[model samples]
Target: MGSSCGPTGPEPGAAAERVIYLDNAATSWPKPPEVLAAVQHYLLEVGANPGRAGHFRAAEAGRLVFRARRAVADLLGLHNPMRVVFGANATWGLNQAIAGLLRDGDHAVTTTLEHNSVLRPLHRLQEEGRITLTVVRAAGDGYLDPDEVRRAVQPGRTALVAVTAASNVCGTIQPVAEIAARCRTLGVPLLVDAAQAAGAVDLDLARDGIDLLAFAGHKGLLGPTGTGGLVLADDFDAARLRPLTVGGTGSRSDSVRQPDFLPDVLESGTLNVAGLAGLAAGIDWLHGPGGGPEAVGRHELGLRRRFIDQATARVEGFQVAGNPAGPAVGVVSFTVEGLSPSDLGQGLAREFGVLGRQGLHCAPLAHETLGTFPVGTLRFGFGPFNTAGQVDLAVAALAEICRQERP
Candidate 1:
């Protein structure tokens, strides 16, 4: 993790065919072998609908699904596992929370650091006159002050305060505990979009006073896509939150009405059992004694520091979005002179086989906040499996591109 690791970049002539992947922000790659095995086990060995039948396969599937729920709960430091609800992804969970909870005349407070998953839905609700939305602005450094968030709450009118745990574009970790405390003081429900923070940060849902938390299984959790969930607080009243979809939950069969419980209320129809199986394995690996969020975060942060330090030193006219000194969870966005983000990204891929994400990163407001609006920045997201060598290669690739394009 230190400079003693030496230059890990590729050799001068050995760059063309080697692949350097630094796009973990979108979705993690080279998933843990345990995740793949778990998915295969679910599909091949226990190919049965969970909670639908009394047979052995169905029972195994049901047990696996329940274990996945508990694994997510444990990962987030929630004692009651029933509060975890499966969804297609964090977007699905965010929609359920935004559309289900807020009603006409209700007010909700969010920030510019949100992804479209949060912004679009809130905008729609505001446009439809369902809820009055207030977007609190973060500081120029991309850091949101808790007091500023508190001032945006409308007391009796504010039904919910939604926010992202970290910025997806520039990787600024928000002051979640401070904001959660303010929300608790106002007796307003808090919903956290944890798509970037799940396995990259240590989140204590109960201790942090978060009412609801939404996270993606594919990113930090190292699970397959189409796997994610929302965790509700123990005291959270499900009656206030409505289901986006209602159908057979494999329970409450006698009545045609939707089940009035924790998970069954939110999860309806056939669940993504295979994906959930992989998610469970991912969480298990994350929660392993030697490997946890604390360890994973430290590893990613080291790599992030290495990349940022090298890039800033080597790339001329390099501009890093957001406060480079601020807290982050392994994501960095930067721009070089005389190159569009797309062009720079493409050049890295074509010339160096370095894969990175370019453009607004699905968070235009975040770029707007960073003053990189229309053009955006090249983003390199590090994962647990990413090494110092990979980070070095990316930096060298960018440095080379910057030199070639600028001169």
Candidate 2:
């Protein structure tokens, strides 16, 4: 557990040395070597526009894109790879799903523990008089009961139900499958944001009954930035989803009209072939022989347990945000009595080179639910690249920092 496949400190003679990196929830660092290599191969060897031409390099580029879609499909247990569509990131994917699914006066239900990506879009739609939004508050521990979701959806009136699979701030794993069943019963389509859950938790598209699933490639997927998308269910009609952007999809170019196909219907313009190449490698690494999500989860959970145990024991006024007994990923949020979250985070980085995130972690509603809003909790997010020694370094840094600051 000391060192694995993830990033470590900077090399000698490097001016700004990196120490312990615990901000993986924001974006995983030190992507697998395979991922970097795949990206490099795409840039150097497979240089061509995919699906835009019929040349050999273009075909290779298209194959790279196709392989990426299949990799993501395999990760989500989706049978049809064509149902997956690429975008800039999960924000793009979420926007497409939310904006495409709902219309004027249509009602949608969501949870309080949502990132701005979900909240902002719904709020914009609501403000525009496009859809009526209902926010189901989570329990004090950041847990949402499926019954609460069931109660929020207005049966036939609710057009869509959106929820994050895991809280970005506190790492609380929601009951998406249960909520999906409820959505099914209510005849409502369910859109799940797996930004925090993908590659950290298990997700089966068919088994979970998720109509639309959006996820980031860089987070738990361990891919490069600017790569993410959504996967539509097999029976889910692409015709219902209006294109967020319409342009040359490299298919059906004769009519100058948008193509009506699974990927082409949503994907327009040149695809991120290089980014997808790395993403595909990341997914393959996660599901392949060298590494898997199960192994990664176990490692990160061990680090989480170590940090929580050591921090609570060493720090006088330490407080954990969510219920530790509940299901979660490798995220932990806490606060100390005397030090502000910003101060602690900055001090950790400055003094010990221990990188962590502070504030609401881009999920204000989550912090509000955890009663840590306005002033948020310090967040430590462990990843596959992290080590047991790094966790110890973080704990020691926290203990020392708290001891020095406390009266």
Candidate 2 all-Cα RMSD: 2.4
Give each model's clash number: 0, 1
In model 1, where do residues sit more than 4 Å from their true spots? 1-17
Candidate 1 lDDT (Cα, whole model)? 0.87
Query: What TM-score does model 2 achieve against the real structure?
Result: 0.95
**How well does each candidate superpose onto the true structure, as a TM-score?**
0.95, 0.95
What's the CA error at residue 214 for candidate 2, in Å?
0.3
Per-residue CA lDDT of model 2 for 163-187, tens digit only, reads 9998888888899999999898888
lDDT of 2 at 270: 96
